[model samples]
Target chain A: AQTVTQSQPEMSVQEAETVTLSCTYDTSENNYYLFWYKQPPSRQMILVIRQEAYKQQNATENRFSVNFQKAAKSFSLKISDSQLGDTAMYFCALSGGSYIPTFGRGTSLIVHP
Target chain B: GAGVSQSPSNKVTEKGKDVELRCDPISGHTALYWYRQSLGQGLEFLIYFQGNSAPDKSGLPSDRFSAERTGGSVSTLTIQRTQQEDSAVYLCASSIPKGLAALPSYNEQFFGPGTRLTVL
Candidate 1:
């Protein structure tokens, strides 16, 4: 079984500031993947970033980046230059041998101008 | 028309009524997934269909929930008896199979707009 955990229920960030959301996952498989998805008010889920477990380097997409620690099983998302549009629900997911992703409870991020 | 699409974006039903949600995955994609997101909760996996293989129904909450993919293109999730607890946003996603190289990006999922089901 795979489990993903996001301890923070809500986070706030000022415009142009940076915020980091914490996430940790547990899986028996050595090869796996981690992802961060953002759900806006429209309720459409958009992929923010993805990281392969085997990769030593972290993954980044524009202002969105991930700090992935394979041994510690920690994958956190950091958003730089936060904007009002970045306010949304962020979910962390893990997919391994099953190819089925298990998602975290989600962290509601609010960016204030 | 290019991404995953779901119908009846919003549904309102009374308790004990049955509801059916539909999903149409992207063309040529062989993997489809259904998930449920309740108020202030994370997404709960409902079921998964990969190509012609049997769906992984382990994540289904109960017998009341069932899904089927026909011709590996379209899928429908049927709730036998609706309950207030069943009220949530149902999401559908589709992705191409992971190629032999196993590049993680190749299997990235494309999600639909989602259907919000409200049971009274």
Candidate 2:
């Protein structure tokens, strides 16, 4: 079984600033997938970025990027030039051999304009 | 085209009543998933369906929480004897077949807007 953990429950950042949300996971499987999802007040979940365990390079999408340390079992999301619209609940997840993604308790991010 | 879609965006039911949530996955996507998110919490996997194979139900919290996907496209989650704890946002997601290719994109899941269930 895979388990994901998000240590921070809440975080705030000013517009144009950068913030990083921490995530850690444990899995016995060597091959897996990691993801960061953003849920806004509208209750819509939008995929931010994803990292494949087999990949040595990090994953980035626009202003969102992930620092994945496979050896440490850590995957953290970095949001650059944050905007008020970036305020949302962020969840980190891992999918292993079972193909089922296990999510961590989310971190609520508030981007202040 | 359309992303995964869910119906009855909001549902309020009595504690003993049963409520059914619906989901329509993207076209041609062979993998579907059900998840629950309580207030101020992360998502909890509920069930998963892939093609005609038997679903993975290990994540279902209890027997009262059951789901079925018909015709490999639409899915319904039924909660029998709903309890107040059952009140939460139920999310649906669909992705391409996991093993279709070795590409990581195949595992990307597109999600629905989610249905908020409130048990009174």
Candidate 3:
């Protein structure tokens, strides 16, 4: 079984600043996928970015990027030029060929003016 | 519409009562999934529906939980004799067979607003 862990339970950043949330996972499977999801006050899970275990290069989506260290089993999310809209509860998840996902507890992000 | 839609966005029921939650997947999507998010906890997979095949109910927590997909479209999750521990937000998602690459593979998932259930 795969397990995802998010060490940071809360994070705060000023508007236009940057912030990073830490994540780690335990997996024996060589082929897999890592993801970060954001849940705003609206309570909808929104995908931030995803990294393929086979890719050496990190995954980036506009203002959101990830630092994926396969060996260390570390996948962290970085939000650059953060906006107020970025304030949300973020979750890390792991999956492979199987569609089922194992998610981390979550990290609550707060972007203040 | 364009995104996944779930019915009765919020449901409150007394313990021992039965409750049902519905999900309408996006058009053309062959796979649908159900997950539960307990307060302050991460998502826990409940069940998965792939095409017309019988759903994968491996994640169901107990015999009281069951689900069915109709005509390969809408799906409903039912909890018989609901318990207080059943309180949580039920989320629904759908995707194509090849995975997210068609979704641009961002490993993205189109999620519904979720049905928040409170068992009293």
DockQ of each: 0.52, 0.57, 0.54
Report the lDDT tens digits of candidate 2 across residue range A1-113: 78999999999999999999999999998888899989898867888888989999999999999999999999999999999999999999888876677889999999988
DockQ of candidate 1 against the true complex = 0.52
Native-contact recovery for every candidate?
0.50, 0.59, 0.52
Candidate 3 docking quality: incorrect, acceptable, medium or high: medium
User: Which candidate order results from sorting by lDDT in descending order?
Assistant: 1, 2, 3
Model 2 has a DockQ score of: 0.57
Itemize residue pairs with steric clashes in candidate 1.
none
> lDDT tens digits, residues A23-59, model 1?
9999998888899999988867988998988899999
Residue range B60-90, candidate 2, lDDT tens digits: 9999999999999999999999999999999
**TM-score, each model?**
0.95, 0.95, 0.94
First chain of candidate 1, TM-score: 0.98
Candidate 2 docking band: medium
Q: How many backbone clashes can be found in candidate 2?
A: 0
